[model samples]
Target: MKAAAYRLTKIKGKGMGLVAARDLKQGSLVVSELPVLFIPGKSNDLLVQEEFAKLHPKKQRQMMELFDVNSTHGGAKTPEGVFITNAYRCPLGNALFPTAARINHSCAPNLTMTHREDTQGRAMIRTACDVREGQELTLCYTDPWLCRQERHEYLERMYDFTCKCSTCSLTGEAMRESERRRERAAVLRVKVAQNLAMCLEHSTPEDLLTEVEEALDIARTELFCEPTIPLMSERAMVLALLCKKPELAQKYADETVRVRLVTEGGHKGLERFRQYAKCPSSHPGAMALGVGSLPAESPDLSAAGRVVPPCYSPMSVVPIEGKGMGVVATRHIIRGELILDEAPLLSLTQLDANLIGGSGASIGSLLLDKLQRISPAQRAAFWQLRETSDSDVGSAARASSIFMCNSTTGADDRMHVYLFGCRFRHNCVPNVLGLDTLSKKNHMRYRAMRDIEEGEEMTVAYVIDDHNFTMGKEELDTLLEQRRVSSCDCELCSLTGPALARSRRRRKKMQALYDESKNYYQPGQLPKLKELISLIEEDIQSPFLVADIHTMALFTALEDEPRSDAAGYHALEALKCKMLSEGDHMGLEQAKAWAERPALARGEKGSTCEYYKPLEFPYVDRDPDMPFAVALRQHEEDVQRQAEEAQQKKAAKKARSKSKKGGQKKKNKGRRH
Candidate 1:
């Protein structure tokens, strides 16, 4: 009954069909309903029979009405032909809806059906274009751009009907002209896809703007309306963000929403673009590429090195004793001190799916284009990067290898070749740390994780995470050796003789302890964790691992109902370790919040967090040393007290109402006035 936008009517030669009840605009909701019958598999005659036999007589009759018993094409064989002709695919099955079954097919349809799960899994038919009153509502069973010959064959095979639509009925030169238009559109489609990929991977803001214009021109040539040309609107949004053009982004974002409503029924990515449209600068990648540079300060001299501009100083490029060139501190640098702030000279991203993994020509062109865009000085610096042992490689191979060795991937799947930053060589246990803070308006910056002596070559971990530390030593050594262009000569890697055996033994014991403690159920886990922490501290400066230990320690302390001070101390320790690691991930943020107010982080009596065993802790547990923690405990107490008072008042009022109702009922019964 809710599918009321159209009414069923008998149409000439087309059997029963749905016609628009009134004049309707494009993108207007026409009808939405759940399927009446559903079954798995395409040619499931058994399933149809079994399912039909179980249905009530009235439902059976309803299904019978949909199929013409007399006609060969109309379910005359087994009543399954009707379902085969009409049912659409859904999860685990094909679904048949009663009201929608009446809607006949058309090659040039005014309505389009989009299956949606957001509205409780209802399949919706919406107007693809404006429709006049009494006009038939139809949906094309195949792609509208299919050639006329193909459309005819597809329709005849699938639905037992020949298409006589406007495009299909054309003859002679008209038919040839339509085919030509389709052929041209198909060719342009590939070009448009390539352009979009290039824009995402290699184009500047200006290039994205050009793509938008070119796409619109192609769409116009193909006689595509605004709703049909989705890419033009999408590219405009991306271009707007890149150029910090919020208003333009919003305009295109809204257009995209409207177009999606007509064709796809909804767009899931709308929310992200909507937020970007509202404030383009709020996006993580907003204006990250080719923006104005930060102001440069004159080079400052320190004890052993000089800090230089654009690269930032007390840092200088120097050759290491056994390794290649690396960055070194001129002065003694304290922990957490910023080492350098630098942007890449050239950044490249992957090409589109169609262009990727083909001949190396497309990727080579992209690399050359990026090189040309940079300043001559920057280009010269990029060329000065040392050649590897491989020399017989071709131009494409050489370029790709250079990037593979020197470039680092950052946010947005971007591979950046830095003139200076890439010089900081790999150390499994390095003292320096590097991270891309694109959202913070700093593309990439390096900082000291520990105190650095003057004239020491600053190094960062090449494998950025703790995975290698977690692995067994032999496996880790094998994997690292395979990946290395040269031998790793770091303190841990260079060990040999009995010392190497002892080191491996300690690592094996440490990993075993770490594995046991990670489960939180091992006997003497606290003592074993202490031993693990001592081992890790002795081996390398892995603050990330320290942070995990402290986080685990906090939960372990709380579970034992230890003094809240000990819990708070563990929380603070974890927070400090995360800060030292220079990580701003969700885990670090949560740790920081927990350290600030331990009581709030702990669950309340009936809160949703109560069901989570990990979050369950005594709310009264408060660290007396932490003023904010004490304040949070007091606030929660007050809230709980207020909630109890409200409950009491409600109960009293209910009791009074019950007593008054009883007295009134007695008085109405003439027992007492």
Candidate 2:
């Protein structure tokens, strides 16, 4: 009995089209009507004719009144032609909806259609986003991930006209960029499918999580909302079942349901997602994965608020003397306390170099394209960030520079620019431990490395590696210079006299021991590994490196005859270190499992533990005292020397051949005389 939200109208060049009857908010229902005639299986002339004859006389007339492009475009006025022109695919089969058939196609559509079985097999159309009055309602007819050319070809072949939708009407570089994004999206779609399949078999949960997060990033960037619903659902399932993080699982499930409601009114899986959101352990997959019915509670941050804004709350964005702006603690914060957890404003995955530059696409061009597509608020937030580039550069170049200066590698290995997270100033030795939380949540989490008082500025290491801990002050400065960092005034960087020398000596020894541990295990390596742990703990308070050292110690302990008690101890230490480095999750779970059961340390293949193995470090034989840049230049010189030597040999061989030939000619002339 409710009035229709849209009225049929003559669209300028597109014949009949649906236009909004009034201003409609997102998710508002535009049409819900049962089919006038429903045909089962693949529709053909005979099938359509049979279905049409079965329809009531009034219904038949109504269906016939609907626009038939096949007949109007010089094609035979057959019943099947009209059926193909106006029919919408339903759960049972192809169904002809008189009202819904009038909707036009747009590459960037504001409306979405779904078949609703709950409403007695009625076709439902809803606004994907807000629509103003008199706005033409449209839905994408072909695959949304298809490139513009492919889309146009399909539309022209299937329908009788070429699509001139707003997206298709784009010209020049803008159009090429759009096409590239679509092609990339399509490739990523296939990758996601393959990864999901692999996850069900040989792939680790972490690998699948990374792939899903990357796919979701592209989907969000491209405004491909429908694909995200399924991705979020999968993410929730994986977090709950495999990862055993119920709280995160619930969060994703809730998000999935919200997105589903907004995009497609509701899917059949809507109720299931709601259940998962309410109780993640209720899912059958959780039981199979041995996940217990744990309460879905967020990680306790104690006094820290669950969510803090970028501007203020737990931390205040304040002006530092040298640094333009930096985050400062507003209150006393305890060690391991969560300081801030924020999502990225912009994210980009690592594309192949060929793909990045093949089609005249650079990071700057891609960034500019992304900027233009983002919401006004997001764009404003991005622009508000510090721009270290020259002010006179073009917008694309400017965006690229801003991104380069502030972006950090996320847990998924994608580059992300966080509005608030990037505000924390960089220090060689920092007071805060910032990590991209290792989940599909894609949050940059900043935790306190040590307790701090109110008004203290929060700082994090811009880059963390063996170099940060092992390199001396001068070497550190050289490395930072290479990275384009201005300077560091952190406590360690400011050390003078004996304090500085001792720190350097300790780090040098640590680096030596670390490199030794990476090679084939030696007879007396256990003591050296223990020393490395002590050095790391004393000199640098980084739990990640500490965890790495502990893992090495565990490996050494496992190699011993009958595996000593030290193996279990080191396992426990590794677990504690991992917990500090990367909150409670699957990494902690594996470490706990190893710690609880030392027998598992022997590992199935007898080489190393099956659950955990240290990553291999490629050996680069360079002098310990040499700066990286100097070593690089020396390498280039060595390469040039080899090239020159090869050239000299070739020239000498040619000269000897010429001399021999001249001598042979002289001998022949002398003989003739």
Candidate 3:
């Protein structure tokens, strides 16, 4: 027999109530149970009765004893009433968890009855906070956010019980103070919403930082942190990145994960952030934080390297031959220039899901509310957005459709619909990069990767890895076809026949070489890294790919000597590659910083590397005579063979497509007669 952590006991006035058998820590599981009976959301009386009858008589009796139907209406004998009074609104529906239902309601509940599905599909109740032995466990029946009076009225009308918890029982000044704070929080929401927009669109980093700070202040004043923690965490990271403080950004990223664990609980949305937290440098521009200053000899490579020039603004929006409307250079924009810093017209995030679709409110209502708050000019700009084929037929749905279609998702899970940023056409091999300033909640910054001549069309990547330089041509084309975007006419995308085959072959060789060298930690591993570096150097067309390889090489080199100068060289090489290909401002700085002092990259002094483990490298544990070098060679040969096979298949597909097109044209000509 399974031993329970809690037991049901008769209380003086509250009928049967749950009492904790032992003390439990916060987040401890108190009960894991399946519902005795369930009424699939708002079922009719006949259906409810039929489901109830299907249950065993013993289980049915247990549920009936939990709630009294006669108390509401004398001798009515309503089984549905009994079930309704006791049922818990779980992920499934209204369910009668015999043990969970016995736990009485409180405005301030110690135990949070979350509807969590286990591997076996059983619903579990976990303690939100600590509960002492013999103390009565309670859960909130209605919204815990309601004011004292509102809670009283809600409880009276819905459950026919008056809440007398510590919060509800507060009297005099204490009660008034609590209510005042709640009112203040409600009022601050309008300002927070407005400022969030401003933060996204600010021209200067300082102004953007100011707006973010203001939002944080308001969130702190709210008293409850659950609603605003995610925003705060994201802002902290953005601030750190902007200020060139990677360590500080990492701290906030850790907090973001912690808060998500407590609130959202195992959400798939958190994985991207977790990866960022684990390796902040993996981000394109994140390396800039590592270096305090740019080298004197180094060309002004990014807007972050110096103050933005006055003329650096939206020069002109011009139509391209193949691509749609794109931002064009009016003057000679220097390498590492700030071309545009425009704010989003409309921004939507997962945080706004409830406000948009939950209960009485909707996306249209929320969009209207936000639209009304902004200036007339901003509203006009929003309306000017070119509606796509997916725009809804109706007004409300149309506004939502326009926003959704135009908006682009950022790292923080926000969808920002920009006025100017969206105009820049998509290119597989772009000369500029768009960076999300998470600190500002809803803003992105565009920086020049290289010097732009007058009349040149400025372009940014639509998908981060969806490019001929990064992904295979086939994969790139498939994604473009899905998005309904124009086929990329970039120099790299136009490769055909022998030229395309040669590029693919080089890329495959480089990939295989990288794979072979990345894992080995032996003394002989340096030779493999040298080979990989040589291959990367050979494929000089895409420096972005080279930078990533060099970064890996730098890490591998660091294992031999904690403060190896060789690692520093690789870092600088990687930085140069990144700057040339993607204008990675952060990567440039990080490389410079690492070159100056390699010790900082190695955790604290005397401490082991935080990012890598000795166990992962076989040299630390494996026998000295292990044939690590031979195995690596074998792996490289195998990878090369696979790459050759893949290339042959690709060639076959292209030939088939060409043959089909020629046949179709001939058939069409015959039909014209």
1 versus 3: better lDDT goes to = 1
Q: Which tens-of-lDDT digit does each residue in 30-123 have in candidate 1?
A: 8888876776334377778888787788877777777533365443544586677777775334787787788877756777676643554567
TM-score of each: 0.42, 0.42, 0.40
Cα error, candidate 1, residue 372 (Å): 9.6
Candidate 3 weakest lDDT stretch, 10 residues: 291-300
RMSD of 2: 29.3
Q: Candidate 2 has what TM-score?
A: 0.42
Show where candidate 1 strays beyond 4 Å. Answer: 1-3, 39-61, 67-75, 90-94, 171-174, 193-195, 198-228, 236-254, 264-269, 273-673
lDDT of 2 at 179: 81
Residue 186, model 3: lDDT of 50
lDDT of each: 0.61, 0.66, 0.59
User: Which scores better on lDDT, 1 or 2?
Assistant: 2
Order candidates by lDDT, high to low: 2, 1, 3
